[model samples]
Target: MTSSDPGALHAQTLSEAPCGRRLFIHALNAASGEGQEWVARLRELGFIEGEPVQVLRRGQPGGEPLAVRVGVSTFALRRAEAACIQVMPADAS
Candidate 1:
């Protein structure tokens, strides 16, 4: 991958991932308190390592709610929640 690519050798948070590119779950960033809850919920929703994920669409200009598909399930996640998911490009692995 090129240097400009966010998922070249490292993981990028889902919220900052470019739309329409197929990516894979690299890791989950679990913070304290509510952030941990979000991460846990995300895991329960099938956001796991090695799983394929894609950014279907984004909300308006600000890009708050992101339409993301993980495996065979799609979810609408806010930027904050999406940030909990760390993903790498499909070819990274």
Candidate 2:
């Protein structure tokens, strides 16, 4: 049997990362009650980690607005807001 290559593992980890891809909530960071509410809304929209999400569309060439889809719902999010979210690749394998 072939053992997993450490380099391959690391590459996978980086490539499957959600850093550049719009992803589901996965988990929420510390925040105020209002912040939690907003996070909850995102969750309700299927912004949970491991959920299928795609960058359905992007806003202006270099704008913050981006169209993302969680399940069947599509929402627009700012780059800063998107950064708060962490996600795993939908096609990790």
Candidate 3:
């Protein structure tokens, strides 16, 4: 990743974030082949760049679904969906 890349510089997929820690949206990656619709839907749900988010909890066992909070809303997302979202430490900026 380059310096100009928003997903670079201490960035990591949201699914990998630790529960209860504050994080900020860095960028969205469509490389997973989830299509533009998936990206658009995530954005529509307030998963925009610079938005603060938190991984509230992860499902037991395989950790398929993750409970996340963005802005004023919270939603459960599959690990694949959460993988599409890049995030950084809330103190990075």
Candidate 4:
């Protein structure tokens, strides 16, 4: 995968993000991180380390908006924005 490609970096879903995996903020397109608002929101939503995330959907064809579940809330984030966040498969088994 290219250095700027988030989706290309990994191909696993949230349900597969087990419990002790390490995931990187690959992208977050329209989610917005300006002024750290998005970052704060994400943390509040439980998008922190050791948290499990599942990829509900890949958004549209371009992968702009993706449906992901962090902790108990599901959010639709833009590709560019998703690229900023990082994550790893929680399940190592």
Q: Decide which is better by lDDT, 2 or 4.
A: 4
Regions of candidate 4 where Cα sits further than 4 Å from its true position: 1-35
Off by over 4 Å in 3: 1-7
Candidate 1 lDDT tens digits, 30-82: 64578988888898999987899999999998997999999889999999899
Off by over 4 Å in 2: 1-25, 30-34
Candidate 4: worst-modelled 10 consecutive residues by lDDT: 24-33
Best TM-score among the predictions, by candidate number: 3
**Model 4 lDDT per residue over 41-86, tens place:** 6666666655656666664576547677766677876655454465
Best by lDDT: 3
Residue pairs in steric clash, candidate 1? Answer: none
Instruction: Please report how far candidate 4 places residue 5 from its true position, in Å.
Output: 21
Q: Report, for every candidate in turn, its global Cα lDDT versus the true structure.
A: 0.87, 0.52, 0.89, 0.53
Ranking by TM-score: 3, 1, 2, 4
Candidate 1 Cα errors over 4 Å, as ranges = 1-8
Q: Compared to the true structure, candidate 4 yields what TM-score?
A: 0.55
TM-scores, in order shown?
A: 0.86, 0.57, 0.89, 0.55
Q: Model 2: how far is 38 from its true place, Å?
A: 2.6
